[model samples]
Target chain A: MSIVGEIIISALLLVGAGFMLVGSLGLARLADPLQRLHGPTKATTVGIGAILMASMLYQFVGHDKISFHEFLIALFLFITAPISAHLLAKAYLHMNRTDRE
Target chain B: MISIALAVSAAAISFSVVLNLWRLLVGPTPTDRLLALDTMVINSIALIILFGMSYATFIYFEAALLFAMVAFVATISFCKYLLRGNVIE
Candidate 1:
């Protein structure tokens, strides 16, 4: 890979990894489950998205092949993450309501 | 340069996975545990992609995609079960 491509990939990887770490840290330390939900649903998803973007760029420049498979995975993840988070939140609220009543 | 970045990122992700495990173990409620499990699935996907990059192979792409699909279904179904007391109606 060229120097420019390498630089971009390095940055993406580092940033993604940093976000992932922060998200997990929040998940482990947060006192409220609702607060914890924001960490993984938002931060972790963005972290993985950045990593996937780096992978796609790596394939294009390093391997000299254009791969859409990474894009497919990213698209699927972006589409499903919100739906899953919503469902999980709703389930949490329902359980809380039932427990209190 | 790229190799060093990859190694560092891999280490960070591994640590995050450990943190997710910690949450899973001590989470106060079932919802908390489920959230941790879901986050762990995402981290697993990140690890798989990093493995593919390290190996310079496309085979793992398919595995990652399948994992994402399965993880989504698992999360959704688990949520449904929690909400309704049954996975499927």
Candidate 2:
């Protein structure tokens, strides 16, 4: 891979890893279940998305081949994450509904 | 440079997975556990991608894609069960 490609891949990997770390930290340390919901849904999804982007670039720049398979993973995750998060949140709220009564 | 980055990022992501495990084991609520499991799935996906990049292979791409699909369905079904007291009903 060229120097520029290497640098870009490195930056993306580091950034993605950092985001994953922070998301996990939030998941572990947040006080409320609802509060903790933010971490994995947003930050972690973005983190993996970034990593997949890096993978796509790696295939292109390093191997000199076009690869779009990573995009399918990213797209599936992006579409499903919010739906699952929403369902989880709804379930949590319903489970706790008696408290508000 | 790419190898160094891959190593560091892999280490960091692995640590994050450990954190997710801790939350999964110790979470006070089922929702918290679910959240942790979901995060762990995402982290694992990232790890697989990193491994593929490290090895310079294309085969792992399908593995990652299939894992993502399976994980998503699993999460959704779990959520549905939680919401409705049953997955199918």
Q: Lowest-scoring 10 consecutive residues by lDDT in candidate 1 chain B? A: B27-36
Residue-level lDDT of model 1, residues A2-97, one tens digit each, is: 899999999999999999999999999888888888888888988999999999999999988898988898899889988988998899999999
Q: What TM-score, over all chains together, does every model reach? A: 0.97, 0.96
In candidate 1, clashing pairs total 0
Number of the predicted model whose lDDT against the real structure is largest: 1
Tell me the TM-score of model 1: 0.97
Q: Model 1, range B1-89, lDDT digits (tens) per residue?
A: 98899899999999999999988999788888888888898898999998889889779888899999998999899999999999979
Alpha-carbon shift of residue B63 in model 2 (angstroms): 1.3
For candidate 2, the lDDT comes to 0.89
Instruction: Tell me how much of the true interface, by contacts, candidate 2 captures.
Output: 0.94
In candidate 2 chain A, where is summed lDDT lowest over 10 consecutive residues?
A91-100
lDDT of 2 by residue, A1-101 (tens): 68998899899999999999999999998889998999888888888888989988988887888888988888989999899889889989988894588
Candidate of highest TM-score = 1
Misplaced by over 4 Å in model 1 are none
